[model samples]
Target: MSHKQALIIYNPLSGKRKKHSAFPILLNKLSEIGYHLTVNEINEVNNMNNPIRKACTQKWDAIFIAGGDGTVNQTIQFLAEEEFRPNIGVFPFGTSNEFAKFMRVPNNIIDVVSVIESGCITPVDLGKFGNRYFINIAAAGWLADITYETPPFLKSKFGELAYCLYFFKKLLFKKPSDNISINISDTVFSDLSLFLIMNGNSVGPLERLIDEKICDDGYFHLLTYKKTTRIKLLFHLFAKLLNLSKDLSIIQHTKINEADFMLPESISLNLDGELASVNSSYFQVLPQHLNVFGSNKNN
Candidate 1:
């Protein structure tokens, strides 16, 4: 028996080009902290679901994700589908690390390991997209489409620059999502190019884009850009990254708790960089859903 039992699900193939190998360090740290780690390394996406489902069913004392956003999203999707759930911790070992960035988890594996070893659990919000769930953001549209097109390996090496390149590539090709319809609760919106239903304060490398105070406020933050030209898309990203725009520009940012959507076609969705889809559906915020180790401000 161990002082504290923890279940760690990780993706060994994650990270940029699979270059960052932090599993050894993470294991050493968890051992030092007395957590009997039941580690599972995912060889494929579905491999994650079973381990997480089993851990939650048995109620592991703490659940720690040790990969990038893709692994985290898959694990959360599995956990959200189950009846039993446990508090979660993180160690950033993947590329982009967008969710980790939003959680203020250290980019370095060792630093994040320290944060988890301290045993501080913070409750954070999760966005429920149809029956599936997302931890950082659920997004669709032009910019989001780039998430799928960009090579996953590029995300690890270049980080946010990878997105910028793909966005521009799509823009050059005049590629955009079919004009879609969105309904946020009672209000209906049309001719939208993209929408980001989010809970984390930051996405990708835009740390300041999301204000930290609103993260745990029982609300989900959203940003959308109306039907506009490629030039306008460039400006939208520029404004969001530079903080030239705020959360209420009619085409920039807003806070949303729930939304029902109808897409023109079966468009791909980027949920924390993981490609997901459901026949055009509904989403809402599950406030304080999981006990998570994250930014201390909300805890």
Candidate 2:
């Protein structure tokens, strides 16, 4: 077989720096499979508005990202707009790893290396928020802030627990829910507490939060939680997470290709674990926007 070229983009701060150990192993494995590799630390490179965009601007056979959802989110932002984008390989080293989990990419580095060798690629849809693209979710409301505000030191020490700690603390002193308006295909939803534009089945610890079958369905799901008390909203979220009941009338869900939102200045959307603040935003689904390496089960 002919050799192929690939790029490896990683974040030093994600997932307790596990990538530092797995990277050399990945290098060996890729070399064994005849892949010529180029490596860039996402945080270290300062040129071209960060290395992810600069590296992705070139053509290659594949690009492997060894970081958490935030790193992958940055990489996709550039690749989504490129015509000669390479196939994506994600080594899920971040907290939650929601996009990789939704894509069914293996959690361990060993399995990911094998998947890369197998050459299974799946086309996946992405949610475009304004000029940005998110692979897993775009969220707004009280809970969204936890993803970005949690200190990096806490995440390094506690991993997922860091998010949980911040969550409970915020829940106790939670502010009033924003009275937001969203228009999706002529339907308007107002007075929503939590707004989630989901492209995948999981968000943070909540898995299969949306139908697993519709993950790549060319349209994104807009879920609005009615403005309710924080305790009640938590109950509704857990109920949905457990699939505990069918009478989830408190939550409104719709699938659409595009939507418009009017949000409060205080509320910002969390796109794949990163913060994006906007008073008004437009969201659209780019169907099958990127190709990623994953098991056949995901396809």
Candidate 3:
């Protein structure tokens, strides 16, 4: 069999322990699996974009990204425009590697490489926010902006806990938002506090949002929180996150192909753990848009 060629696009700033992590082991494993690896650290975001643009110009059996959700989203944004998209494998080194986790990519770096070498290329759906394409999840409203608001130092210091702590603190001081409205075709959601559009299953720490398999479905999932008191929203959200809020069902969720939003005021969109500033925009799913190198997802 011919040897495979792989390109690993990494953003070192995506995680704190990345340098000390099992990254080298994974690279060694890739080499042993009869593959040639081209490793590149992103010195600048724009600098990396050009190489990715050029990557599709050649033949790469697989592309590994050593970053978190935002990096994945940025990569997808570029690949979506290309006529060819290689099977994507991720190191999940970013703050909220929700998409990677949902795909059941092993947290152990060695195991992650094994999954990629297993050659399970699963084609999955993609989401579009206005003109930008996102590989994982996107959201707007109250809790969505937390990552953007939290300081990088705090995130580096506290890791995932920082997000939870910051969210709790922000809820206490921030003013309640005005009732927002969303309309997708004939479907309408009014007095909403949060809007989430997902091409994958998990969102931050909330993985059980969908009990059904998510990927390869050719539809994006939508979750909107109803207008409610701050305490109640917090209680319900925490409960849901902990799998204790089944009876309380605080969200209105569905699988949709596309939707249009109408917001009374502007709330920045969070695209895969990064901020996307948009007051209102059309959202849609690009069915089976990209091939991913991971196990298939079950809802």
Q: Which window of ten consecutive residues has the lowest lDDT sum in model 3?
A: 42-51
TM-score result, candidate 3:
0.89
Order of quality (lDDT):
2, 3, 1
CA lDDT of every candidate: 0.74, 0.79, 0.75
Write candidate 2's Cα lDDT for 1-299 as tens digits: 67798888878778776546877787888888988888888776454555455545666788889889899987887778777778889988887787787778877778888888898888888888888888878888867789889899888888899999998888888774688788877878888888887876566777667775455679877788888877788888788879886655778777878888888877878898898754349988888878889842543
Answer with 1 or 2, whichever has the higher TM-score.
Answer: 2
| Candidate closer to the true structure by lDDT (higher is better), 2 or 3 | 2
Minimal lDDT window, size 10, model 1: 40-49
Inter-residue clash pairs, candidate 1: 247-253
Predicted structure with the largest TM-score when compared to the true one: 2
Clashes of 2: 1
| Cα-based RMSD of candidate 3 | 2.6
Point out the higher-scoring one by TM-score: 1 or 3. 3
**Model 2 regions lying over 4 Å from their true place:** 44-58, 278-280, 296-299
